[model samples]
Target: MQRPPLDPQLAITFFYYRDLPQAMRFYEEVLGLTLAIDQGWCKIYRICSGAHVGLVDETRGMNKWAADKPVQLCIRVSDVDGWFAYSQSKGLDGLSRLFENDQLGIRAFVFRDPEGYQIEIQSTTRTGA
Candidate 1:
């Protein structure tokens, strides 16, 4: 008999933070993401149906927090302009103006979270983006 393919239940992208509470507040109040799982030092917020972002305490997590953040978290949304306006109103750090990339067929904006982690919000301008 043929075996079934590997199937994962959920996907989570983890980011380490020096202050978990501050990060939690940003994710909850600013991003409006619901807490799917709470493991004390590690908090998992649901981005969508199956996608999640885990905020881990650097002191307790496997990886330690660093000053420079080379990684960026990008979320695809239906309304890029609306999100940009909301982000500006919140006075987010390192916020970038909404711009479009014709080659990539996307309208996007970027901003840093409370702990300097860059987050990009974008929407597809054309099909199959």
Candidate 2:
């Protein structure tokens, strides 16, 4: 089968919340993501080039918050230890000890945001040939 031509642009992962302001504060202050766009009831944050996260107010969104959050946002970084320490200093919830995963080729740790969203900070463990 012939593969379709790839013309990738921007990507946005959205999370629905009960309190938009609180989620905005966490993403802005704690995560240090810049607000790229605002749609009144929804706020979009830039994670990096071509990547963003949109926080939507539950009342205005199609879905509501679930007790069992099925999504885990993973951010690949150059310094996993540094980010782990920083999050530890901030007293972030569910902070896990940094561990290397041979299978995944990464060293990572997990933490929860104020709204119970799980975020994973990781660095590549494999060395280039």
Name the candidate that leads on TM-score: 1
lDDT of each candidate versus the true structure = 0.94, 0.91
lDDT of 1 by residue, 13-107 (tens): 99999989999999999999999999999999999989999999999999999999999999999989899999999999999989999999999
Query: How would you encode candidate 2's per-residue C-alpha lDDT over 1-129 as one tens digit per residue?
Result: 999999888799999998899999999999899999999998999999999999999898888887788899999999888998899899998998889989989999999887889999999988861
Q: How do the predictions measure up, each by TM-score? A: 0.94, 0.91
Candidate 1: lDDT of 69?
93
What is candidate 2's local distance difference test score? 0.91
Which stretches in model 2 have alpha-carbon errors above 4 Å? 1-6
